[model samples]
Target: MRFDFEGKTALVTGAASGIGRAIALELGASGALVVISDLDAEACRSVVEEIAANGGNACVFAADVSDEDAMREAVEFAQRKGGDLHMAVNNAGIGGPSVPTGEYPAADWRRVIDINLNGVFYGMRWQIPALLRAGGGSIVNMSSILGSVGFAKAAPYVAAKHGLLGLTRTAAMEYAQQGVRVNAVGPAFINTPLLSANLSPETLEALAVMHPMGRIGTPEEVSGLTCFLLSNRASFITGSYHLVDGGYTAP
Candidate 1:
């Protein structure tokens, strides 16, 4: 299971905090030249500085993943900094307001769908050609356990995640023979700020108990799985979905 990404360049979106931040740090630590993109410009810069201080090559770019123009600019920034972009983690997304699907606010639904679905689409549509020119690469879409199943109060979020999985599968099939591997990571409950703020403590405990492991997972745990999927070590694992969900879906 030893995999190295030395000499490779990786672009990670939504990297200012939470899962995206964890992924970026892990990728940088694993020897990939990293370009961190986030809507929060300051946060992005901080991540780059931290990586640099830690002896990793990194640069930061700010962009709203939902904006096509922003996504393009972010890619260019990565290319300029890393020289060759070889991997992408389309992790930009949001959790829509919690409510019954029927009562979900239209604006919130649109916002979530835009960032979670359209954002990834934009990232891939633009990155694919560059990745091809760079001689192929791996892509990891950050879906959720909701991608595989429905959650009662999370209509828009569930829809977006499910869409992400479909997009990953379709893109992987389309590019497999061409040497690109596309995959999705569906984590159930990880200790990201998203969960801490958006989800209540009781809900978190309930989610933990739902897992056979009797606890939620961690960001580093998910990072281990993501790093594998984004490396040559997973050459034959395209069009796949991984569950790093503390056994939540196993039962």
Candidate 2:
């Protein structure tokens, strides 16, 4: 699907790899000037180069999503480079240690919540104003199927994701009247470098079968929905959570 994002500027966090990378590339290809924000400078630059090679315009802004100052700087960078900020995708997240909540380490839980939940808040804390300043815009917060349901031995991740939905909804309601739409995209078991690095092939195959589609989704699949929510095509959408999970949460 193609979107006409001409004259629009977008800021995408954690855009150097995985699902974030896919969204950034798609936005750029669709004619938006993209700001690739990620902690890895090298990886962010690579994404920028890839977008440029594909006849798209993009720039890299390396920053830790958990840092409010850095996230603010990222938004400023996007506005300075691409003009008004019309779009944003808060996709930076991390899967915490697989341990029962009772035994989950305080440090690990804090880290997970900080990155997966608080980071998104920071992004929007700065992003919403920019969009409002631009007159109108959209924001897609990357959630997970876990946002709707619980998973054993994954309390921190699940909690953070669940919290994200509340944040998305509140932001949507507050800004919808102002022409800034806010929504969440929940993807399940996407095939990304992070997933592959953490799970063995045998485990991955097990997870694939858990989904009704009998396969884990691809980052591009998640990106398709994400880009749509960011586009004018979803102009009527806001304060809702869309699942691209192959029916993982359907049952």
Q: Candidate 1, which segments miss by more than 4 Å at Cα? A: none
lDDT of 1 by residue, 1-251 (tens): 44688999899999988888888888887788988998898999888887877787788888899999988888887788777679999988887667997788999999999999999999999888778878899999999999999989999899999999999999999999888899999988888887898888999999889889999988888888999999877889999999888777776
Error of 1 at 53 (Å): 2.6
RMSD of candidate 2 to the truth, in angstroms, is 0.6
Provide the overall lDDT of each model, using Cα atoms, as 2-decimal numbers: 0.88, 0.95
Candidate 2 C-alpha lDDT tens digits along 120-207? 9999999999999999999999999999999999998999999999999999999889999999999999999999998999999999
Q: How do the predictions measure up, each by TM-score?
A: 0.96, 0.99
In candidate 1, list every pair of residues with a backbone clash. Answer: none
Every candidate's CA RMSD: 1.3, 0.6
